[model samples]
Target: MSLPPQANSTRKALVLFSGGQDSTACLAWALERYAQVETIGFDYGQRHRIELDCRQTVRRELAAQFPAWGAKLGDDHVLDLALLGQISDTALTESRAIEMQANGLPNTFVPGRNLLFLSFAATLAYRRGASVLVGGMCETDYSGYPDCRDNTLKALQVALSLGLDQSMTIETPLMFITKAQTWALTEQLGGAALNELVIEHTHTCYLGERQQRHAWGYGCGSCPACELRAQGYEGFLAQQRAGA
Candidate 1:
């Protein structure tokens, strides 16, 4: 997927960055377009709490590698949604084996996670003077989280605009693109440098394993997140070889 550069660089946008691979790609996507971009994360007592640390590393590396984007990167906010974890009994928040639930969604799906993330993000954007909210949520190449659906987000956008009485836009750069395309997007946004930054700094493993590194990144290599990332990387390399 080729992401076009934004001509209107004056727009201010807030990104829902979780320090994961998709969000890292979206961050690069936003920095390329928006003039001033702020980031927000939620600490919901996730099993992969290492992502919290990865977010900081990714931010530092991005600023160091691409000073141009670093200038546009603004303040980052982390909200404590620990209550979310306390109330939910899921694979992502608790020590349990991941499997399919009776509802057909994966046990790793944290209910209302994205919805709450967006609501809080909209509130922050309201205060920060940003009219657009960016996230990496995607219905494609995902674990079938309901809140990641495009329709769900569009409806939330309408609800948020009306509730805030302010016009708001939610940007999902990875919404329609596959995981392979997302990798391609990172390269398009910042070339091989950004791709390397994502591979080295971003964290997506549900188990939070970083002891071993793969050609794609660090992960346990068997979890769903790791599986998707590895497959996407292989596809990305295949595309590169074909083009070469």
Candidate 2:
């Protein structure tokens, strides 16, 4: 199906989804601006298998709203980056240490995760006949991961254009937007009403432990991941209470 047009006709977008806050927010963001939107996620074999499960759940959530949202995010593509996970012994894979910051870069940095995710998304865009790829990489309020930088996205865009026959665009809707702003965006896109998704469906726990989640998510509440989600939700809740 075709996506709706905002101001510049129809924009095609491919969302790199993790079924988490940022990606889910970006999915909603892309739907408003693009004519067609597709989502791609990775199964890097992180210790948190719950994340994969949540991703599927989030996909189903979006699928249920496909027609209502008026944008098409086709089937969820799960790529086996298990090898990448094996080599990644940092916080993202096997680090025993807890995150130091509440909402900044942590030890869980995967060297080339976003790189691989975007590469695969670009390839899928080519096959699926899309012209844009959207992701939820926030530099303003993230753990300071290098991959979330603007330059990284630009570099990937260049690399993909050079490596592939078809030219595709990568859209980082949440690049500059803070996590708080992301929460606002999700609410603006009508996702906040789906409070269950905001809480249960998305996997934000770096440890990947479902038993660890609170009303917010699988966050340790002290770790950077949990802290950020908490902080952002605080902003979201406050705004919701204030009515814009």
Q: How badly does each model clash, as a count of residue pairs?
A: 0, 8
List model 1 lDDT by residue over 98-213, tens digit each: 89999999999999999999999999999999999999998889988999999999999999999999999999989988999999999999999889989998999999999999
lDDT of 2 by residue, 129-164 (tens): 788888888789887789889998998898898888
Q: Listing every candidate in turn, what is its Cα RMSD in Å to the true structure after a full C-alpha superposition?
A: 0.8, 3.8
RMSD of candidate 2 to the truth, in angstroms, is 3.8
What's the CA error at residue 206 for candidate 2, in Å? 0.7
Over 4 Å off in model 2, which ranges? 1-5, 8-11, 99-105, 240-244
For model 1, the run of ten residues with the poorest summed lDDT = 1-10
Candidate 1, pairs of clashing residues: none
